[model samples]
Target: MQQRVLWSAVMVAALVLAGCGSAARPASPSGGPQQEQRKLVVWDWKSGEAATATYVEKVKADFAGRHPGVTVEFVAQPFDQYYTLLGTAAQSRKGPDVMLFNGGGQIRDRVDSLLPLEQHVAQDRSRLAGWDAFTKDGKIYAAPVTLQGHPIYYNKTLYEKAGLDPANPPRTWDEFVRACSAVKKATGAACLALGNKEGFGIQFFMSGLGSGILTPQEYDDWIAGKRDWSSPHVRRIFELWKEAGDKGLNSDGANSTAMFTDVFRVFESGKAAHIIGLMSDVGHWKDFGEFLPPDKLGVMRAPVVTGGATPSLPYDGGIGYAVARWTKDPELAADLVHSLTSADALAAFSSAAGAISSDTTIDVSRAGPAVAAIVPEIRTGRPALHVALSAKTLDLMGRLSQQLLSGSATVDKAVEQLAAADRAG
Candidate 1:
């Protein structure tokens, strides 16, 4: 009887040991649908090095708090190489789930790789402003983060030195040119700092010419081969470009000089009376306080050329965030985009980058004087020709401008080349 009882106890112990072994089996590594991890990766170029680092830290903390099982990783690159790097990563399908896209034709080039945010936008419409800019073929691919508008920034002291009233800025192209010529003749200052290296200075000049040279529909028609390149309006603008270069109103050696930094320095040093690039430069007058006094600065809309069709308006451009079509976690990617483009996030980003937010809900006053001066123009729907052109046309225009400015191509010849390139493209 005792031997039988001992045998029964041993059998029960063995059964308990088998049960423990089954319970200790490892879980599936693939997350098995029930325990999936939530995480996202984002790429942006606007954040300053130090500010981005700090902002990323805060984002991580905040995101983790809101999403107990999720994590976010951010990578910021320099502006010059940002797009190139993104293009490479996208081809390999290793790009960030969310990325910031610079406006212009380039946005069209990468449209296929981007996830349309229409559903997201429909769910959260107020987070967006100027949605028309990011729509292609009726699909929304990006959310505008800031209204990158260009306003003429001039030196108040230089205006006074040229015997011009500092309070009254030029309202027309003729007035602007005369004022510039006066400043150049009186104080030996450069009327404008231009560089062909970046193509922005020339593009800005062309945009200031307004709609007469090419209306949005005309430009589209030209690109589509319906309009002639040698149209009188087109020739007129080309002739005007040549005239500006010949009159000595632009920077010296602008054709060969890739010296954008020097150009900005010249403007800041009061040697150049005006700059017609980003509105942020006005704020830079304060950020780079030693370069120029904030109180000595003035802002105005880029003047309209005499015969242009569209009214003088501030041209706008900026970086936008889009999700990748092949992203493994679309929901998470959408969430990340939503967070970064939120009103609060935009306010923080604008403060960090010294830019204006695309969120109309955010107060433009928050961006301070420089950005505020241009807000009215943005809100009023001033048409800009450059922002309306297709990407291929823009590249051809850039090349043509470079050739024209370098004395390698005549105005008539450049126009022909541009038309030819448009045909080939």
Candidate 2:
């Protein structure tokens, strides 16, 4: 996607011992064999999932073709602690040969322990979409697997029940509010499904609605590192977040709800009319399509909140695999990374896991119309606003967002704190 909407890799680093699976032991005294077979250890969150089994098998088969006797062990780590565990492994200098990471600050903050893959992945520059997320100082670190975005996902059946046209979604902020009100009155569904126990709701809200608030030039400038956290439009984002919670748009107990689990269920079960959700993996078209009928799953653009505002997809790299600096064979490890993002492998990932693969060549038409609507928007999509912030700044933003939702912080206060945090970077 280039500057248009570069897909980046969100690597959830996995750690496996170097010696635990290594084949570097000296030849046996008997000369029956020179040494045990080579083994490559990899860490990722998706390896253990049934949905991505085909993807894992594809990469394993591809790598085995290149190196017959080498064993590949994949250890799946819980995402909530993936980075923390990877940190401990990095300090010990005995991390796995390969690991996964989230694109943006998640990968950018830890580049010191990663290998630059530019030379090894040159052949994939034209094939993949999200390289920039894992890149730093003009060097690439990981290959992106999925292009993640925040699109306003709605339940079409709810819209229809509210006497609103499913095909003609709201276009303006006032209109959106009116439509949401209609849904609430007619169907008793919450206007929106939200959870902030992890404080991800603000990230989704900001990115999903940012395009319709910031001008195109302003948006690009923010991505280019000229962020104005104190801008009125930026403050408005926080205001809207607070307003949604206060005005009963969001479901009850939003503060304690886990977005990764409960919030999606609310939307899927027809309790909520809309959610600012992902374009890949869980909480996306595929998950909703599985629950609701495919035709009832709708992807809507951000409503126009300000005059002259234009809406577009907000996304970055989802997750990607990167080679660790301590790996014994950089070339062999890079080969594994290459095989992981290969067309066949990624195609399987897209088909089985419902990921928006970074390999744009993979056809997603069969997945449903929602996927069809999303794929075309990447060309004009902006980098996710939340992804553009530094790690510390984003953490602060999350806390401040939670405070705002809980009535402990005002929009101005939240923006001011974010401005200072961002400036400190």
Candidate 3:
């Protein structure tokens, strides 16, 4: 499944031992026979899910083959309960040797439990795309493994049926809205398949819009309570969403739809013309093969809102590998992370998962034409809102977006609620 990237800012305020300084090394494995029988445990939310277990098994087999002396224990955590289980285990100092750290709230709040990987990173800088998202106060805590950037996925047949030139996709917000409206009018297909059933979907849309519509400093100010959520930029985004809802351009049953299955199905069935999702979706075209013809399926950058100061920078999200601070074998943990994220491993993983690697050394062309076309956008230096805000602030914004989308609250009311939530936190 293609993962959605949200735009909540994750601020790093806590201080920790910098990798440049001498911190006591973790105790090595016991000597002799015990050392030779080392084992590493990994808890991954992505691997355990029914939808992705097959891919997980492949990763496990590959890792085991690469390290004959090492035994890998793979544990899958349900998406809804993964964090809670991780938190409980982390507090007990019994967390997995290596774990998958997500981009936003989870990483922000649990970073203190993670070991700094700057030492490992310095030795193998090629494993990461950029240190900004995984670094804190000059210390790198995680090694980014995959790159998932937001992009527009449109069905070609729907475009043509709506009188749009399938060869030409919209490049601006005005053109995008007009094209979507046209698709709705001509074919009665939803212009865009958006699932609001889970608040994450709405948050993802906000992040994509926030990326191009707000300045980095403005985002920081919003998170710091220096600026109000009722500002024109924030209001404009919500207004656009409201407009989309009114135009019947959004997925049917959006209020109650399951994001990956139901919402994406609209596009897959040719009942929707477009979807704004991770670039990874371009690789998993088989799921929506019926609706998207090979030649007609179009991939493009997310449209920039008119009058926005920032250029189009898509929201990025994916999992990174982080070692536990309390691990008994830090070097082995680092080695595992490095091996999994190595250029060779990345190529294999990307091939299996249909994902893009963060490693700059890898030739993205290996992922095929569709993914190759989208790599440049992922590498753009636009700031991610999720990488910029405090964890608590991000949670508040996500809840506020949900309230607005559900009609349980007005945009202005939601903004006021966010202000209160920010102050309370």
Candidate 4:
């Protein structure tokens, strides 16, 4: 694949460049050790956000205290161009010493350019819970800072207005459909707030509802890279996506809506009863809790569609930091990553940025009822289904998903394309 070829070529160039640089360093005429400059540049999209300011400051302070001589600079890039910029940096061997990454395929595809941080972060392994997302081939390339997962969030006020019991939510797919009908009939609100403009709705829907659609074996196999795109259950997922759109379960202009803050805003404004939301950062319990009463926000499991399916929480590392392999001091950079994931720093991040800290020891009981319901399921949660697919395949899926919504692409054709992509990889 393209990633493998790129990795091989990049690693070779990096090694050669590193070798030449080390050989070129001159020795002191008197044979005394020469002083070396200590500076580290870190890049991330979150650093510039207002909510993350305090968290970023805490991390910088902690890292500076631990590394007295090091001058650390944090470059905050726009999220839309983050990956493209990083790819260019990698190709040119001029990237930052440390950088942030989302877990799963994002970090996995770029592992060749990152220093494995397993040994460096061994001490905090027991305290953190999202390591699997940042690990590849038994090596940890990054330290997770937040736990992100899709949790079904509903508006209790909407439920009550629809003549449904706010105390109890639907437990099956049929029941969920019935509730949606009631919500639509009583209140003109849609059942779900869906935004697919960037093709993110299908990603959220697939992971958010996958636990309820696929059998345990099938689900595990998909995550393990043994996906069966033609499987009946897999087809069922696409069918449901189309069905939801055709039946008007989602709000108007679903395909034109954006996912990031817009999707959350729709749900927060009470335009829909349910949404597949995240556990941390933007579209989560904490964000919605600000608009709706904390008690009015409820979290529910994905309603079961297949007989053998069992709904468990779907999650992984939300975001993490990695040390670049080309850094002058890998250990020092890795140490900075460790500092970023420290308990105090993560706690500050969770508090100020509304993120679920990857550190399991952080208390989130006061976060709200939605978080309370989600945290308990983390122990049994599986990695999200979308996160397993490569970036190329994901992009393809997103495009196909749009056609599915508009009835331009049949489920069969979508599956065929996806199967071919998976096989090609």
RMSD, every candidate, angstroms: 15.7, 11.5, 10.6, 7.6
Write the residue-wise lDDT of candidate 1 on 1-425 in tens digits.
Answer: 99999999999999977776432223222212333547677888755465445445555655566677777767778878987887777666666878878765667667767888888767556655555566677788887776665556788888998999988888767898999988988899888877666555566666655443565556556434475666676677777777778888777877665535656666777777877656442224334345666567777765656444454444444667788875776667777777767666766666665666677666766444555566666665443446656666667777778777777888888878767766675
Worst 10 residues of 3 by lDDT: 4-13
Q: What is the per-residue lDDT of model 4 for residues 8-114, given as tens digits with 9 covering 90 to 100?
A: 99999999888764322232222133345388899999888888888878888998888887888889999889998998887666779899999988999888778
Please list the residue runs of candidate 3 whose C-alpha ends up more than 4 Å from where it truly belongs after superposition: 1-37, 47-68, 215-230, 281-291, 308-310, 366-369, 381-383, 386-399, 423-425
Q: Candidate 2 clash total?
A: 15
Per-model lDDT: 0.67, 0.87, 0.66, 0.89
lDDT winner: 4
Off by over 4 Å in 1: 1-37, 53-66, 123-127, 211-231, 280-290, 307-310, 366-368, 390-392, 423-425
Clashing pairs in 1: 212-309
**How does model 4 fare in lDDT?**
0.89
Q: Judging by TM-score against the true structure, name the best candidate.
A: 4
TM-score of 1: 0.81
CA deviation > 4 Å runs, candidate 2: 1-37
| TM-score against native, each model | 0.81, 0.89, 0.80, 0.90
lDDT of 3 by residue, 213-259 (tens): 66656765753447566678777767777767766678877777766
Better of 2 and 4 by lDDT: 4
